[model samples]
Target: MVVTALDLVLAGLVVGFGALVQGAVGFGMALLATPLLALIDPAWVPVPILVPAMVLAIASLLRERGHADWRGVGWAMLGRLPGTFAGVALVVLLSPRAFAAAVGVVVLACVAVSLAPLRVRPTPPLLVTAGLVAGVSGTAAAIGGPPVALLYQSASGPRIRATLAAFFAAGTLLSLAGLGVGGAVTVDGLLHGLLLVPFLAAGFWLSGPARVLIDRGGTRPAVLGLSAAAALLLLGQAVLG
Candidate 1:
């Protein structure tokens, strides 16, 4: 489907809002953007969103490069490759209706997991596990950060942000390539994704000033609220589609 001007404006707003959250919390762009974009048009999931997500990931990583944990990033990448391929297989096999439903389920599950009081140490084995989960979740639904973010919740804020950003950057690229190989994404979809870059950049820019506000408190509630709303929308689409 061709993305109309109205679609571009709506998607830009959604991407901007998501980028705001991500700028504050380090890892929620997909969780916030993917489901809503899917509602706008189910075609917006996976690669369309993944393309912009990678760009955001790179920007975030570069901004916080000093704090990035290279060792952790390395381990995560190890698991992400295989898991990404698995997700590619799913995209190839599943029908659009089924895929939409599954994306809804993933959004809900990720929210549930985020709300749970689970503490995870970012060990190599654990990082690999999180990476694997992230790869599958991200590639399938563009909601991959929860797994890796949960593991890094205990780390210093900057470390958590930078490392997760790095993982996402690498993981998103792999997912995109896999999607390309599977013929699930096309140049048009990627171009559509690129169109949202200006909005994403705007959000990222505003995030710098707004960071202090979210840093104090309310970030968790805000993130959960957005995730829940998006999840509901995605569920509705799945049921009605």
Candidate 2:
């Protein structure tokens, strides 16, 4: 791919905003990236978004040591591994249009589930089930937050944000590995993902100061609004697509 000045500038801006969303709410990279990038080549969306979000998460961790339940994340990842293989296999078998359509519809579904009025704390079965959803969504769309985000309680804001950040990072790493094992992720994917790390870091830098009071309840409306808009955009695209 050509390293045009415009590409860096545009990608930088997108990544910066993505970091702010992630920094502020601890999730939203793919939620923010997908609907926006679908305006360009929808196929170009996932890796770039993941690259920045991963970096943003890394940067967010620098502010304070966000304690992550490594055990929970591991269990979730274990459940997702097989599903990740399934997703990669599905991706390999599907056309770009078909993949995009499926991703859009499923993203909308995750949004609905995350925002459901009847909230239920996840049990062992449910957590593993959510992991499956995370794997499929992450593999298909690089947008996996809604599934596992629902697993965290909003009241426990610190744990919610910290754990979700860890989960997002873990999910991406797992999916990236799956893509490699399945021969879906190419050298270009890895190279591109690494190359975008600077933009991701820059995004995190811009959002650094804002992390001070990120746990406030005020952020929910905006998060949900962006999510709802993304879902609606994805839904429309899926239908018309």
Best by lDDT: 1
lDDT tens digits, residue span 16-96, model 1: 888877877787888778767977997777677887788988998988899999999999888889889877877677765
lDDT of each: 0.77, 0.65
RMSD of 1: 3.1
**TM-score of model number 2:** 0.82
Error of 2 at 209 (Å): 3.3
- In Å, residue 72's CA in model 2 sits off its true spot by 3.2
> Per-candidate RMSD vs. true structure?
3.1, 2.9
TM accuracy, model 1:
0.83
Best by TM-score: 1
